[model samples]
Target: MAVSTLNVQKCHGKNIEGWSMSITNLQAWLQEEGTVVLGISGTRKYVDSVTMKWLIAVLYFQAENPNAALSFYWEPLKKAVRVEGHVEKLSASESDEYFHSRPILSQIGAVVSEQSKPIVSRDVFIERRAMLLEQYGDGSEQLPRPKHWGGYLVVPEVIEFWQGQTDRLHDRIRFRRPKSGDEPDGVLLHQGDNGWVYERLSP
Candidate 1:
């Protein structure tokens, strides 16, 4: 997606140096422009299962909070729409197909590692690894995709973008609404050049 630059005068008590934009706003704009399935690139930190679970809980809290910025009906907008659900497991055939397509090392690692579970000793893990190696012998054939590993689809109900400026004049934009028409056909984009783009803000 092409990013459009918006000039701002001031943001966050700083002078606007140059044009800036908000990622959330940009996403909202794109949705309005009839684009879906945006790909975002970021670092993937290895989060333990507990951390992941906690993160989900926090999201749920914000999602359920009535006064949060990300809340769906906050007049001034509080939070992004939260889509929650269990990870769907792939069918046996689907799992087999995906496993064969994965890198051999990944397959082996998945087979050997006790995901989302505690391992007491490195030696025990190594022993399990050696045992799997002996059994699989290089993982060339399709090894079943782990049952714990699956997928979840998050449908973003709102997307906002903000761009930082030199003097703290950041650009902010938001996209959201009744997602009714066909895909990529009825998305709406709202552009906000100044901080006062949307009305109804209290002093």
Candidate 2:
């Protein structure tokens, strides 16, 4: 998931100091910035989150994985911005590589346990563990990746950026792409394809 911040600029023909400005620029910014592949902590800092406070938006930007993004509204930030996207399970190759790299015991335990199910007790678990370990005996042989163990790729269809000020006044910027495409038209020219639009909202 991507966590991001939104800010306003008074020069953009609206009252940013008054906590309202069009999000055309903000949307463009995300489309461009979201493509960055920094680590989680690096992304947070690189996005310059300190520019916005009071609202924390979670954005899933997977440029390297898939070309998608997902933003969720924090309870407190719900009144600020709203965006949605789709998620896809990771591929078998990805899961298999990770499954085999785990410690042999964990691989065996994964084969035995049904994650997220209600288990009887630790003793029951331990009993199952003992049996699996005795049966497998920690061999270099590979174990199959359990169907349930895998990650997801998220594709964001729309993005909303928001900032807040005093007296419940706030600013909201929404960026939406057509269902058929993701490339956007913006202040800066993107390399290829253009299909995104932006709108300002009352807050």
> Please, what is the TM-score per model?
0.42, 0.42
- In candidate 1, stretches whose alpha carbon ends up further than 4 angstroms from where it belongs are 1-99, 137-140, 179-203
Minimum summed lDDT over a 10-residue window in model 2 is located at: 20-29
Please provide, for model 1 over 70-188, each residue's C-alpha lDDT reduced to its tens digit, 9 standing for 90 to 100.
11223254323322122122234644555556566666676666544566877877887677667666555445555543321223334455444566554555444433442333233
Local error of candidate 2 at residue 20 (angstroms): 31
The Cα error of candidate 1 at residue 59, in Å, is 16
lDDT of each: 0.36, 0.45
